[model samples]
Target: MKLKKVVLAVSMLVAIAGGTAQAQAQPVKNIVLVHGAFVGGAGWRAVYDRLTHDGYNVTLVQEPLTSFAQDVAATRRVLDRQNGPVILVGHSYGGAIISEVGNDNKVAGLVYIAAHVPENGETEADNGKKIPNSAHPFVKSSDGYLSIAPEYYHADFAADLPAAQADFEAHAQMPTNAAVFTANIPHPAWKTRPSWYMVAKADKIISPDLERLYAKRAHSHTVEIAGASHSVYQSHPDEVARLIEQAAQHALP
Candidate 1:
């Protein structure tokens, strides 16, 4: 009778420990990715694959490029659909959207991939004014929409990318409204949240110096990738994925 009682106690303890361990284990769930201006969710295909392979649920948001409020609304829509906490990742102009939308309680953390980290009431146009105009000839604004000039796509936006790949991205690029650039972000979420930033050292569109300034202001965990263009996520998907993973880990208890 004594032996049987001891055996039952040991089994219960083992089961309790197993249950606790399972409860404590980190859950792999959704990460909603937002792309910058002149691009759509399609741009994140590489990063999406990497995240999915690492056991993350991933959703790519296709911003309307209509205005800041619209973009934030679109991101919030995705955030609402997620089952667990979301890691909100944004690039370039998309960062501005995340800065506003990521304030939601559902957001686990934020990742800026060569993205703008604007302060409250600041607009993309305001930040762009601080940097000298890009020497790359591919960008143009007309009829209230901004687009990349097809000719300079390979050399300016994706210099490190193969000519063929660059050309394809250039061709598939989406046009954004110029008004979106001027729209101010009433609330910048990064100011109140833990954030991670990736700096594209070789970025020509947005100055590297400015990237440093924004990251510093946001008090972000930052990593600098050398020889990368503005589209560093495309040029360095693995590094971007690693940064997102780190951000997610930081959000865990």
Candidate 2:
């Protein structure tokens, strides 16, 4: 009887371990966020909280924004850690990074939030000229690094944010290599992967028209937020989170 009991206990342990492995191998409920230049992962704080509250494993990529190739490498490094399928998200210039990052096998879908959705052989700067909005005056480049003028952070960039907070973000901006914007993309992931886009209608930074054009070109499901500026992710975290959930749940089969 003792021998029989020990065998049953061993069998139970093996079953539990197998079950755990199977659970881990299931499709990932993971979401990886990539931030644009001039901002760190801190910008995703609200969105991160919302997704986490819903029981998602969330990872934020603090892309160095030093160079285009390096940014793509950084994003891929995070994707490498995911065990199952991943929903990749990008905000602002982060869209460009995702266009390349989504090519990874682990990626299920992509979400773009007021981001620069570029195509193969095209650079963000080149696309910018196609639309030719007046926001370029707000951008200042020094020593090959690009940064937005703090003066526009309130009126043009983050109109949805509180003045005090926007002020800090403006001054604490991360300067990206100007060449990164001019750097041509070799492969745009959106060409092959499913995508969703959120356009900040009131965005003076990237222009809503351009956002629409990019979304249309990529064949992305799109939502335009009225009166939202470039900081739409922070101002409307719920909407952004909902869209990401759609991609993770319904979109990623």
Candidate 3:
């Protein structure tokens, strides 16, 4: 009888230890958000709030839309500060940025939000060539920066948003360097990393067909948000946050 009690106690202890180990192996707690062209890190506020509220250590990368290398470096800088494994996420042109940096050892998974994903030796522009974005006829500055014309910005990029907010976003838009579009990735990270993607069906800034192609090529688990424009992150913050949460919950250890 004593032997039986001893064995049962030993088994319970082992079970407790196993449970602790399983809890420690739960999804990564670090999340890094990267924003795409013609936008800044400020756009991630809603998503950031949701993530942080859920106990995630979230950081937003402010990529200078100057060049691809610079943007990659910016993301790398943020990644360098993470304490443990990370779930990297990018939006719009930011997708291309994460595809380059997600190769870091610290990255456990990647999430793309209405963003671009280029293959080796391919530029974002090259990826979109087969099906052009409908938000074209961009306004170009003398310095070679590109932006959506104010008159068309709301309709093209944020139609789902309130008119006032869309107008403000249009005027406050960050123009991307034209050279950034032509820069190619030498090593696309999606080739190795597990990935997730959100497709904005009503996106005019990037053809939905192209988004699907990129997701399919990366073999990423994908979700399509109907009627969501390029600003799906802003218009549907709850859904975006939920997807990121899912990535965090399922990321490999």
Candidate that scores best on lDDT: 3
Model 3 CA deviation exceeding 4 Å by range: 1-24
Q: Using alpha carbons, what is the TM-score of model 3?
A: 0.92
Which digits, one per residue and each the tens of the lDDT, describe model 3 over residues 5-57?
A: 99999999999999998986798899999998888899889999999999999
Give candidate 1's total backbone clashes.
1
lDDT for model 3: 0.91
Ranking by TM-score: 3, 1, 2
Instruction: Report every candidate's CA lDDT.
Output: 0.84, 0.87, 0.91
How much does candidate 2 score in TM-score?
A: 0.87
Tell me how many residue pairs clash in candidate 3.
0
Model 1, span 120-176: residue lDDT tens: 677767787877546454355657677888788777778888999888888888888
- Which portions of model 2 miss their true places by more than 4 Å? 1-28, 136-142
Local accuracy of candidate 2 as per-residue lDDT tens digits, 109-193: 8999999998878888888888865464646565778787888767777888999999999999898888778766778888888
Pick by lDDT: 1 or 2, better one: 2
Q: Supply candidate 3's per-residue lDDT for 27.
A: 82
